[model samples]
Target: MTRRSASTGRWTGSSRCCPLKTRPVCRSQNPRSSNEPLAQGSPASCTAAVPGRERKSRQAGRPDVTKLLVLGAGGQVGWELVRSLQPLGEVVACDRRRADLSEPATLGALVADVKPAVVVNAAAYTAVDRAEQEFDLAQTVNGVAPGILAQAARSAGALFVHYSTDYVFDGSGHEPRKESAPVAPVNAYGRSKRAGEERVAAAGGDWLVLRTSWVYAARGQNFVRTMLRLAAERESLRVVDDQVGAPTSARLIADASAQLIRQALDERSRGSFGSELLHLCAAGETSWHGFAAAILEGWRELAGADSLKLRELAAIPTRDYPTPAARPLNSRLDCTRLEERYDLRLPDWRAGLMLVLAELARKD
Candidate 1:
């Protein structure tokens, strides 16, 4: 798979594409467009045809019928959502160019124009360190934009699906943070996201705010890809050992989201769509250092690349490699609420990591 780095803004290659859940082709927002279109690098047609599955679903008396409007259809989660949500309905995927979150005022008009039955927003100002200096821009995109989307969804009587971060917490306490835990963001990015979550709740009709942590993807720039790239280049790596959280896969997140959406659709008449916030993440936890070591170990075992130049990987504290913005020491999030509500549980972080590493090895 290929990924564009979010931190360095560089392109890197390593793994195969994530497993796709196929479905029938749907009408596109722009029929004559590529997945990576120009015009300010906006997202192109995000729909992909899977005639086999579509026919099967129809035969089963459950037709693919919903109209899904996906924002940030080019990002990690958004990209996977395009594939996973296809079986559910017609997907109109738009990238930043089509549904720019920074332009909050224009979002309402865009959502209204689409008038989709379901609106899933997977975009945000994700540059954590950069956000410290660009707080205004971050607030506009991460805070104001969600409310606009939520309002639009409410007006259209659509189910609003949003992804949030674990940064909403201040990283205090040793135990996993629950959905009812008090929020105390210690950084600009966290603050902005928390604001967005609140706004969504206030503006919501049927909505779900899914909070996740340490999100990685087989195709996107994430911790897994970063670790692999670094190991290839450097002989030694020093990673933070203090901060801990599950390194969740974007693929897993997208699949879980689709499942939750299906459940919501089926139980809407039973008042299952009441405004709710749930933590959706991989099981177990580890520090950045532990995660890196696991990635390397998985690669070595799966790829048989023990001849790599990398020799040592040292564990360091957060203070040793400080960034502009502060990070939570404890990023662990309790997924009990999500499990109870959706009747699903995520795989452990190590399991997901192994799958990604295997994909990477196969691609190489």
Candidate 2:
């Protein structure tokens, strides 16, 4: 419970540190690399980790997408993907309110009803704080549902895309993690996401899993928006500054997913990417402190009010401020495969945040 200024890159007071002593932590405190030697800047680039690759084109006469289905349409990433994919086809988006994931029999039935050319699963149970007590629900939506949807996609002869979290890793790597890095999720939420990845992957439905980190959007209830709101209401706020990660905008995920989906469809004839996971977030990385500062800068520009002042923001380790789940210290993921396969080059997080918040300012 703290306040932050979207207009100024500053805060007052601080939160508590993490209680666990895992590894030498990263600024993001992703479950992975909690003990690895820390890198001071963006995670180092790594080799592509897509397990199977050999370029192939889609059926020669593959029609441009005429219909699409997006699950978890209300989530930040799902919301963005639905809008972005509209250009390729008729998008039918669904959230828990509109549909229930626990009843996969029902979800599968719904997919069949749509018979979409492409299926995007963006819905997930993301209450990391609450997930400690709701592991079953997280598994039901984040794990079980994707597997069922993949089956439906396979039966319908449609390509499937699933969104995952960086939480899948144990965060032991000092360097950025490759897609194939051994996973040892420290939290229940991470465990559920990893399970979903494995379940959907085993189902084998011409699928692509894109794992992302620190997801936020201007309109959504994300870190960026939360920090902004806090800044507006109070003089000081405490954030877990030690946790290092790339603050990804949902818009970026949507844009990259759309681009890669198109690439996968086109490569059906020479399948270079499929039934594999990819990393799709911003290019560079930063700590939560850096991200908050950037968002505030954008807010000021948008509001045309730079007069606001902020008290010194304090940074402390995760132990100082505990959450319900154990987050990975290094939330970083390697995107070389994504870059090579889709020819997509994502911008750094700061740049993307500015773009997102500028638009958010207009809305406010």
Instruction: Output the number of the lDDT-best candidate.
Output: 1
Task: Write candidate 1's Cα lDDT for 1-364 as tens digits.
Answer: 1111211011011111110011111112121233433223233433323222332222232334557888877677887888888888778887766666766777777667665667899877676666688888878778888999999988877889988889999998889999999999998878988999999999959999999888777666566776777688778877778888888887888889999897887677455456799998899998878888888888888767673567988887777665667788899999988886777767888887887777778788
Using TM-score as the measure, which candidate wins?
1
| Segments in model 2 whose C-alpha atoms lie over 4 Å from true places | 1-65, 269-273, 304-309
Evaluate residue 40 in candidate 2 and report its C-alpha lDDT on the 0 to 100 scale. 18
State each model's CA lDDT, in order.
0.72, 0.66
TM-scores, all models, native as reference? 0.84, 0.80
Model 1 stretches astray by more than 4 angstroms: 1-64
- What TM value does model 1 have? 0.84
Total backbone collisions for each predicted model: 2, 49
TM-score of 2: 0.80
